[model samples]
Target: MSAPESAPPTRPPAPELRGAPSPRLHNEDLAPRRDAAPWRTWDLFCWWMSAWHSLGSYTFAIGLLVLGLTGWQVVVALVLGIAVLLWGCNLTGVAGQRAGVPFPVFARLSFGVFGANVPALLRAVVGVAWYGIQTYLASLAVMTMTLKVWPASQSLTAPQFLGMSALGWICFLVLWTLQLAVLHRGMEAVRKLSDVAGPVLWIAIAALAVWVLARAGWSVDWNYREGPALDTAGTVSAIVSGAFLTVAFLAGPMLNFADFSRNSPDARSIRRGNGLGLLVNGTAFVLVSVVIALASAEVHGQAVTDPVELVQDIDSVTLLLLATVSIAGSAVGINIILNFVSPAYDFANVAPSRISFRTGGVITAVVALVVMPWRLYSSPVMVNYFIGGVGALIGPVFGIVVADYYLLRRGRIDVDDLYSDSPTGRYWYRRGTNPNAIAALLVAGTITLLVAFLPALSALAAYSWLVGTVIGGGAYLLAERVHPSGSLLPEPAAVPAQLPTQR
Candidate 1:
């Protein structure tokens, strides 16, 4: 494409397409160039696999099982939730596909050339919270296995530190260290590990579910809820709200999905990957989870949340071993991609030159150690609160980004100006702060957070993401009309012949 007349002055020696592609995105801050983008459809599938195939994920999936709802009700809620998640994932993917940049870098557009740091820091802080939570859950799986081996340790009389047994701490540190090793290697290793781990986890869960049902002499049913559980009828409201919860719970990571998508070679791969992974794969995983939870309830008189706990209840050594390896390994993969990779990019965004990938990763590791995650997972209320608080911010960002890309920029971006600091740069709005965008973000975030956290609005908890998305997107449109920026800065002059057409 030819540079527009309004584009910035052509630099001497013009922006010529360089002969060599950039080095792999291994410095820890950006997408590695070494690996080619996977098929878009595959990306979504991978996310779905990673999202639902974990210990914490199972807990949420089986939540409907014990909600006193009929089997059909449980299916209704789960399907609704998965659908919501798919929609949010789809929007998030588009931003990445268009920008060819990770989340933090993309923030440069909305937050301004220099003002992007705020959101980056906010996201990193949230990442810390999740890092601790997932780490703790992984340790729980380890503790479960250890208790089986040395039953006597279960009767320790001494008061333990941090509400955790000595064995728990050991396992936490072990798993924590393992995550650091894999994450330290950078994105390629994380991707390859996830591709393997997600599938392995699914297989193990399927195996465990089948074994449990066969042993219990029960058939899987989508209509097995006992009476009185299905009494909370009000179909219209229930279905809509149930669908909203699926997306709300997943809003946090979905907000910055570009962190992964930016590494892709194109948009099609991301769409395909997410569609298969998030929509299809997630629904299947949740179905298996519900079945297992129901079967376990029949056998033990209570629905199971933790996969390891379910495995223990069966008292089958072979099934237990399979569950242990699969769940633990899958947890490790998730920890690396979601928690570890994000903070590295976030921290780098904060101080690109000063903090290298490894240094930033170590910093996060220390913080995770200090938080002592196990205590947080001690209660369901705590997990929901933690999720609610972070999840609140997700909607506003999603709204703002979608509105900006589709309506304002129309999916076109100048690859060079993203790094330029010239006052004339297209993205340097209002002294490096896009007031309209910033205002929209704050307004949307406040509204959603209230919906999620306020006692009076507890009923709206599931719809928080939607509320924020609408508010943010609406606010931006209003602002753009009232206070729009001039056109996006034109592409830089002096185009190199070798520049790839896409990025």
Candidate 2:
């Protein structure tokens, strides 16, 4: 199961030796690192803390609780789901740290120097959708707090446009502008903001939990029995589905994990950070969410899934304002790290010579607005379709990348060839596209799409991501066997002597 090796007609003069400017494929922004990575284990830990503290995470946890499972059963599902995410992150992160390149650049290794656009663009589209959704959620928090502090402004909700009230538009634009400002300052600003916001979020959630405990008492019921109780088989099915949903929620971030992992100082740091962030911080957040949901049901006479709505129910204006700010802060952090960074690099990768990182980010922001994510968020069906459908497509891309890197290529990649468009280049297969990878992607993605969209396969839709990954990986391996490509194993002599130095 290894790549084949064949000599080409000629080897172009090394760019360094020819004294030509660095190829269009090699841009300073997307190039491998020549300096040390600034992020450490703690920074990585904060990364997940910021990501999981969002309203989206809160809603996901609440979804598990209402699935008729007891609290302990929900806990078990959360642990299992986070474990899966942690493992995936570690696997993807290793290549990024070794190569010191963003996810799109790394993807060029398997998908071809030019063909990598398929997966990178797919990731960017997903990122745009999430950016819009998170912006809308954060705006809701601001709108809620504004109405609380000044009830007179509630009347401004008239003349709704695009399914959003006038106030909603104002708040959304404000939050959007703020996010753009942070992104304008580059990655340093993002890291500093996450470091502050993550701890503040923890304190805010802890305070909310304490308030709930005082109001609802310790005897809150963990068993959610709003409807008919499920039998043993049904309960087990629900637990498994719950875990799958958890993975779906995280599929976007997990696929592009290399976007962040590329900033890690070392592989050890990536592992330590992911363990603390995904496993420890993730489990704790889910537990706290469950407790809050249970207590809200007892105290408010109904379960409140949305954190913004829950904050609106609080009696004290001070606590309400604090909670709103914390939720907004968390949303902004996640939006920037998971939603903004990936697409910026992805879009830039599409036209490196013309599209700088900032321009790519602007493109992403504009597309997010065009998507009008508010309508999508307003409907449960739309949420399931958009989020779940995008997640399903991501699974095949993940499988192909992992299988190619770990199994076929054995973790060896030619950094120069990744950017090269020359026909003789290792990654320059058939006019800069690898038909095998594309075929495998299409086959796996088509099946996953069918399962997601076809009513006949409704029962199996929940496992669409898992199904796609397995089938996609297997299909690529089989495709490689039938149409063998040249060996990815590097020859020291053929390797570019002027490859970027790793930290």
Candidate 3:
């Protein structure tokens, strides 16, 4: 709270890369509490729970079931896909632990110190959109419960703007307001909420699954599709598509991974957290999801995507108890973690000095109302396009970061230099931009765009992440080789403003 210590003399301006902009030189000043870095293993496990236990998650799981794959095949896809996710999360976690920053800050190396804004803004926009959609859905749940308990409220329905009924608007606004309240409280509150929401959601889901099985006599016939799609021609395509979708779902969290990782004590904590969260925790979630899907077929004569609806079919009080808890908890956990946290951190990344965590969160809440997110989320094609488009960029950005850290930089970063505008500062390439990274991102992003929009290569659509990652990574590595920048720049004596006290 006292006057901050002054930074040392500025370094000489480094020669600029072609088309690079001049950077503003200064020291970064964001520092977090040191004690917050250490999280328990269970906390890490719950992170995945928060990520996976949501309405979208249930829809994806049920889609897999309807894909005609046998239960065993679905299990294989889920296991293999999540295992890959575990590895990606571990690497991301390590980056976060070392940097003590969020995803957008680390992106400075891949994009220019300023160029990072492109990807950061892209991710933040998506986060804001999701915030609106999730808030709307949560409101729907509340409205449904309200109307059920008080049938007289049904008369409140009336014409409204944007196709939403008056009651729907009320619910949406109420949920939107509540989300802002929680998000404005900061990450500590988000963490505690997720910790409770995650475990409670899983327990409720498991109970719902058990009740469904008991009601349906727990049949194991599976009734998998036995045609060409399942047998050979369409098989590989399905698995690949499923995997790519999973990656896209993960891209948002992966981008912001550093926000959480900076709180970790060491790389091992990151590794442990990711392993439990992505692999073990994810596997268990998929299993319960599939069981519910399978059992619902016998009870309803069709697959059910909404667990709440699935529970409503059951007459038992026990079934209702489980269903209400699972859906509600999952919604809250996901709303806070994925929708709230990502955008809040992103806003901070853009202007750490100007925006505290709470202000950034409120911005997200207001934007959610303006967008009418429910309409956006309801369109499957739009969702896929949005996810695929942004997701293609995720791999390239991640690749660039890994290259800058492990390969070009030799695992060393002058944390203070990240914020400095001086040419001589470690990261300030001409005008504060990293031209090679920008070029590579453009090239790799092109490949992703092609895969997404091209009709001829439908088979390759699901491999968008792989294509972008390989192309982007290989391109960056080649750029570095063709135009070496010597070893990483030296570390500074003065600590960066955002540097973690723990490390």
Candidate 4:
């Protein structure tokens, strides 16, 4: 588990199902989750563990430690953050559990069929950018471990191409290829991988902590402060900021959570899995990360947040291979799930008849290469400004989706019309796009960017996602009242009947 989530696709499409979208909009990859069987609670739980418990997450926990909060404060912030994530995942998971659709299809409920494609593409672009940047970062770790094992390979790092060394390029491509290999197997394949990787990552996280703790003379520092002690106000601010970033960190995955949840059988499983995976495992890793990072500082004479770097300092081949390989796998998992899978379905939706899931994913990889993500990752400012700005829309989109489904429609859904393009279709808005959603998006997204980028509003930056949700959902609700959406049926119910439509 790394940072985000998505539905699985990339292989060739399956045979068309009984009830599906119009042919032009149809693709096996975009169909509702198969009814053959639903995923067990453990399966869903494993996904969160595999998707989130990664090297990046480990370093993030260490960052909270350095914020000068006491151990208890750090724990409080982490628990709060993970709790918010749990609630969001469970909330969004409901739509998928009840509807059995991915994010793009679900968005159609609010954004309109054709209009939804743009939002999907927006998410795809962000996913691809992060994918490339993360891939490059993970490759560096791989290359470092490779050189540590075989000193002779140092020569491979001497030559440079496009700002990356030869060895870096090789490692990057290999990882890139490996993700594709697993992804082309589809969502179920990813589930199997997560099932194993989740628990193994937990072992690796705990093992690193234990190893570091032993080396630090079996001593534990309750408050591993990195700076001057903060007063209550400063302490509260730090905790809030940390928790804010933690929740914001998963905004991408949280919005499209149904991509994963669609396969789940029941809402109860969603809640239970989120509880175990996010609240329990997420808290465990945060605490473990704190111990490993703080203990490493005592052992190595400097705080080491990066797990790969910390493991390398340990000077044991066995530990090096285990930690580094696991770290790399976690990064790969995040890239595939959040980055690859998102764009795969998004790109496929653009022209379903023309592009298969594999083609869409290939496009994402290609564009990631074109962006040369190293450059993006090189500047923290640019990464934050661009990615953050692009990501601003996500919260607003969530606002609209929740408002439309849970409020305006009152949980009623016309599944057939969701797939229909007929003039009389329930979801067929003006030209197959929802102006209200577009309007609400601009309203909320503008405010998010203002909060994120404006110096005067910098203090409010932490709450930008929450602000977006309130404003976006509110604006869209108002807009619907003034100019109602065509998606709303003349006669609708809480649980819509599967009656034949005029079209």
Candidate 5:
């Protein structure tokens, strides 16, 4: 459905309460929506489909299979893990739909106006990291195709810069520019691209799977028995770890889900979309990955975890070119939807008056380049320690937001106070900071990080997201009970209702 006509813009409160126009808490970009959200339930489903059907997600599925679980066991883990993720997404999605605000703005309800920046910046930094990593991954496909068509291009590998070959840098920059172009067109362009890309990539993947099966035969082993065999107890632990990793894989998007959810017209749409996108679509994709991996091992004498490599094995240049393009397109689709958009909104929220959405996105792109994520991608140790650690931190913020919205506030948010700096404003706590929330985040995040990084505690690292979320949420509940933040408390029964705008 078309969005309704934009309502007349509402001005921020007077300077006495809102301070100078220079530091105004709310701006047009961050404000409650004046027009109806246009996204339907199917749009949300396609959104997840686009996000999930990436080389990185496929690699992650391969990682789960490598854990020695049977195909059915892996499916069980994925279903359970996705259900947990869906629950979290639905909770935040409801809040976003009801408030008609982005994730960072919605954070103000719990984190206070100024304090909201903490979580916003944390999430933004993570996005920048993932953005670079994904861009690098996408570029690899271009590099592979380049070398395939022009073997002479292989000479570009001499004297590598920042651990990347000249050809790799060329491909990375090319894909990076392409992503920026798409992002510049804004959300409508993104929605349209996702709607097309998801289905196209699905067809490509299905074709590849069928070809692999036809060549390798259907007798491929479905169990991961090539490595050391695990006993029943070990097998069960591996399955559970597979489930935990599934949640970790999508943890970043799940936290900033409000970015998309706010654009959704209703909570039911978000729920239905997540169910199909994550549960059903995710399962089917996992099955395809398993079939392709088993076939690759049977045909190539080794399991090809990387889809690009598997495609490179194809003798037909036409098929190889098509597969490479599909991987590149899928990478771009996911990187934009998951990595680029979150930080754009987040950095804009950092100083809405100073940073426009486009500028924030540009800033994110530059920072992604500065991180030189190719180095991170090259090292498995760095991947586990650094990228994994950052993902674990998201759990704490997620817990705090969910707890405050559902438990403390009981699903009621005062939209006006979310922008107000007045002492009387419900959300204006202690010069715009909520110490209680910050405390919970730090405590929970620190412990999770330790578990994720420390060698001695590595056994718990895989489940850090789950552990941190529970601890952070429980801590917030306890802290609020002892030192209540009246801002999030429910209003008196006699007070006139001014419910947050549904659209």
Candidate 6:
């Protein structure tokens, strides 16, 4: 291709928010795409599919059986969960798709230019932790497969250092380095890899389910728990709790969907992608996972949550190699989307002028290294309290942003002012922070934290994500309505027929 146009037209493009003047907030990566944003409905559908068909998601369905609900009941919850995710993604995504900015940049509308970093940092912390955990899990898959083939190689695991064996470090670093190499090539490479790996991972999952079912003589025990069944009220409660658990699993991605959706050509295309991807593909994955978990338990005496372990137990070198490769690829695929990319944009938003997207991603990787995710993942107290504590803190921010943009601002964004720290700029409310936004965030976050931790509220723990969103959103509406913030601009006479040009 020829070298790009010198710069965008002096008049900003329609169907986008572009051309911020401030150096403190403007950069090539964070700026609206001057070139075509080429992703379409198919691309987004593949993106969601790629994000879902991974080692983590495969295990997710099996773990829900601990809820003591039947397979079909679990399926219903999964559907509701994905539906909730779809609703959120569409609401948040249309803003980004139309505005042509990542979540952090667009969020300035609600959170203020500098205060936007509050949400960014919150999301980045979560993304970095999970990024490390997923990489470690993938490395374990590769190492386990190797040890299975060559029993003598078990010697490499003798010395434990920094909570991982020597062989474990080697595998982890190798996977880590390879993933960075792919990311270094940029998002296009990430997209291509997902397009290929996502379907391959699901296909392998289907094969695994078929093989396990055949081995079990085509019969499945719905009572996967090996205990007395839950009563009617308990069963009803479990289904509701299980549904929210599914939502929480995808909440990190759903919260900042604009990271991906900003590349879409139009908002309608995003809606199409979300509909097909989350509704159809998500349902299929949950149903298949349920079938596989049930059959595997009957055949192997326990439900196999980890696909890698199940393939290894089949005792075929060929199946082991295929499953291992697929798991590694799909795990990396989802990691980049779910855990890596959002944080990259988020960290860059902290100082767009100083940090490029690649630099931000490296920063995330460094933090992930220090997070020592294996330790984080292993400690029950840590997982239950620390992660949940931090998670509760962030959930309210999503609601705050959505409420500010769609309801308060009436879906209009002043593109140039998003970059302006100048007190006179339209978005420079109260020296670059919206106090009302902060109040709602704190009030709702505290309640969500209580629901997650207090034993008296244990029954409500599973619903924390939903609770945070609703309470946070409702609080914002009430706060802004009762005490009007004059910082908000009046809505336009009508929605613009074309994108408004930026100076």
List the pairs of residues colliding in candidate 2: 4-486, 4-487
- Quote model 2's TM-score: 0.91
Worst 10 residues of 3 by lDDT: 494-503
lDDT, candidate 2, 398-446, per-residue tens? 8998888877876776666776777887888877788888999999999
lDDT of model number 4: 0.78
> How do the residues 156-188 of candidate 3 rate in per-residue lDDT, one tens digit apiece?
676667978878888777767767777777676
lDDT for 355 (candidate 4): 85
Per-residue lDDT value at 3 in model 5: 35
What residue runs in model 2 are displaced by over 4 Å at the alpha carbon?
A: 1-24, 34-37, 379-387, 487-489, 493-503
State in Å the error of residue 481, model 5: 0.6
Give candidate 6's error at residue 62 in angstroms.
1.5
The model with the greater lDDT, 3 or 6, is 6
Top-TM-score structure, candidate number: 6
Model 5's TM-score against the true structure: 0.91
TM-score of each: 0.86, 0.91, 0.87, 0.92, 0.91, 0.92
In candidate 6, how many Å is residue 422 off? Answer: 1.3
lDDT by residue (tens digit), candidate 6, 172-237 = 998888877777777777777776776777888788889889988999876557356899988889
TM-score of 1: 0.86
List lDDT for all candidates, in order.
Answer: 0.68, 0.79, 0.68, 0.78, 0.80, 0.80
Mind giving the per-residue lDDT tens digits that candidate 4 earns over 1-503?
34223443222222233354696666777776665345566877787788777766776777776778766678789889888788777778877667777888878888887888867877887898988988988898898889989899999999999988899899999988888788777777778888888888778777777888988987767676778899989998989888877887888888888888877766666787788788878888777777776677788765687777776776887778777887898888777776788888888888888887788878888888889888898989878888878987787887888888877887777655666777766677888888999999999999988988899998888778888888999999999999987566554323442211111
For model 5, where is the 10-residue window of minimal lDDT? 494-503
Tell me the alpha-carbon RMSD of every candidate: 7.2, 7.3, 7.4, 5.4, 4.6, 4.9
What TM-score does structure 3 among the candidates reach? Answer: 0.87
